[model samples]
Target: MAETVTPAVGDTPAPASTRRERTGWYVYDWANSAFQTTVITVFLGPFLTTVAELAAGCELGADSCAGYVYPLGIKVAAGSYYPYLISLSVFLTVFVLPVIGAVADRTTHKKRLLGAAAFTGAGATIAMAFVTGDRYLLGGALFLVANISFGAAIVVYNSFLPQLGGPDERDGISSRGWALGYLGGGLLLALNLAAITMLSEDDNPQRTLDLARWSIVSAGVWWAAFTLVPLRWLREHPTAAALAGGGGNVLTDGFRQLGRTLREIKAYPLTLFFLLAFLVYNDGIQTVITLASQYGTKELRLEQGNLIITILLVQFLAFGGALSLGALARRIGAWKTVLLSLVLWTAVIVAAFRLPAEAPLPFMALGAAIGLVLGGSQALSRSLFSQLIPTGKEGEYYGFYEISDKGTSWLGPLAFGLVFQLTNSYRVGLVSLLIFFVVGFLLLLAVPIRRAVVAAGNTPPRVL
Candidate 1:
């Protein structure tokens, strides 16, 4: 939510003064996305894999390591370390994210906490520059810290959505933030790629390694530096509910709040039901975003070079896509627009299942289609969800939102893998995901959105 909606309890009624702070909120998206695209989505895996392969005694640039390494008496594939570390981070984050969200609700310093999380994550990314000479463990350790902090930041950041504006404004605000994120992350990745290309002309192994490390460092710097905008301008948008005293240390209070939250959330069936719908569909969305490259490479026999280009295409186009979707939401309501996007998503999956091999142009067209609906769905999902949350529970509820989306997200991939294992058909594996879209869409329709919004004490948008 680029800013706010439904005018959080302490705010004036849709005042003009809030615009600057809202702009600052959008800048936060711009700042942090560098870390997301550069490190998480693109660079870190291959770099860490290279370093780990070296640690396992593989020659630089060799096709395979021909060995396994033991970490804590567990045998692991050298190429798997990066993904393993990411999974570990997400697993651990499943616990930490709720705590962060609960604390955000309890505290007046939500903005400060957002800052702290961003800086800590950025610091870890900066430290990644020293991950050299078979020190893949060090790199993994740093990323673990960074990834957890990133989740914390998102929870706190999302908590601000309700505090920023009114119902009619939220869809656009959230969509714009997402758009800036795409543009920012895309720009940074492009610049980093250009720098690496110029500096690594010879393709020397050590030079490439150093370039990769510095590129990560640059991403961290980008995150921290741009964060100053929000830190400087985003004022505390306090809730009307008084901050209740628990008479415990901050962490203890946070957990205490979380316990109460779990019990009380049952009162809001709308929130709970919306959350269920979000979890089901968002899982499918995340799976496609995660596995698209693998499907292109292994299933369609697309070139590695072409796959990279496709990723770039998705990143840049998603910016415009997000804005376009926001506009659509204003006209048709975010809920209905999202339902329409799901229809498109189902079509995209069916089309993907039938895409021909060695066809770069068709693959690019598919990517363009994915990019168009991707940002709109996510932005509006968050916008629509913000309405169902009760007053004073932004952090804790969004924590549930974040955790459900991130935690069980693996189910889609698991099902896809099982289908492929049984049928020996990548097309079947890919199309199997249609179940997630269909089921999630039906669940979403079952939500009774306006009734839920009214129950949650939120103003329904004009279109809705």
Candidate 2:
């Protein structure tokens, strides 16, 4: 199992070689990440909770808020709105992205599908501007739609990876995309933060909420505008003509192909092992990104402005961090660097439990640490996984990859929400994420990377 996977050398039709095509693909990352940073990481979670608290008529910061009933007869603490909404979103996407992936593989409208997903998501994000007081249900609905779209778009976006570069070129190229994402996300967040500061009145929660709504609109605009780059330029291999021959039923053929791919995956035990490990650790990562602001605000009593600044700091740091870690991967091997990053993740969670409430600087320091590893770890994992994908089945295989990515996203938030509900302590919930990293770390160790590569008909990178 420890032996590296090294398939015999075989020629693959090289991906598009033009610089414009490559740059167009990278720009899509720059586009969608605005939603990831401004909406998911920085603003929407805390803002929605505030809205839910108002909707439920719960007195601010009261234990009785736990008794407040949401739209679906769902009783959750005022603090529970964002995490619960995200949990629901991730649960749905677990099923959706794989199907989207399968279809993208069978169709030639990959760019069109990508555009539809992005615009639909942007529309949802823009609608968040209408989510005012007592509009928790509306906000939740939009979040669900936007999140599902986000997950679906990412499926198609990631599937393009194997078409963009060969196995040897994937690590650097993937890192560049993530770094671009950080830069784009960070830039929008900075402007949004500044806008929120200028427009939001310190004493007026409602006014602050209004400004936050506009910020959401701005992020959507940024996402839609930048998305046009990839939509116009990133070409897909011709598959549309073959669609007529496949029983003229894209859905049935997609399902059939997906079934075959699922069965095929059983023969690649190491790939399965890696997916399981990724499912666990990436959940921890996603949960932290999703909930960190909420925990900082609701539990630690940090100011929104300080938290926004911290998020901005993370975005900038992560840009460099992705590049740095990619270079580090070249030196130490991606597996070892990824494991090291997981250790740091575990440490961050541990540090989170002990972080003193109302200490913005300390929280920001912890955020900086998270920033340093977050992009690096995720980027490397994507590239490493790319090396193990069976040729010509990139879309279907990456579909399973995304399923692994988003499927487990449900567990972390649900656990965080449930733990917070039971004990009314965010610290306890934060500590619970440690199990993911630890378990993932152990599972990662058991993976025979070299064997996985060879079994999937890939050559293991020399560094690995």
CA lDDT, every model vs. true structure: 0.78, 0.82
What digit string (tens of lDDT, one per residue) describes model 1 on residues 1-464? 33333443323254333677888889998998888777765566567767888888888866445455666777766654554665567678778888898888877677889999999999999999789898977988998898788778888998888777677777888999999988998888788877876777454667877887888899999999999999898888655432554344666777988998888877888879989898889878866775575577556876444665676788899999999989988788889999999999999999998899989999999999988998889989998998888878889888877753422255565666566545656578788789889999999999889999989876777775
Q: Pick the candidate with the highest TM-score.
A: 2
Most lDDT-accurate candidate: 2
Residue ranges of candidate 2 with Cα displaced over 4 Å: 1-14, 59-64, 238-247, 404-408
lDDT of 2 by residue, 67-172 (tens): 4545677667867777888788877876787778777777766788889999999999998988986888899899999888988888888888877776667787
Global Cα lDDT for candidate 2 = 0.82
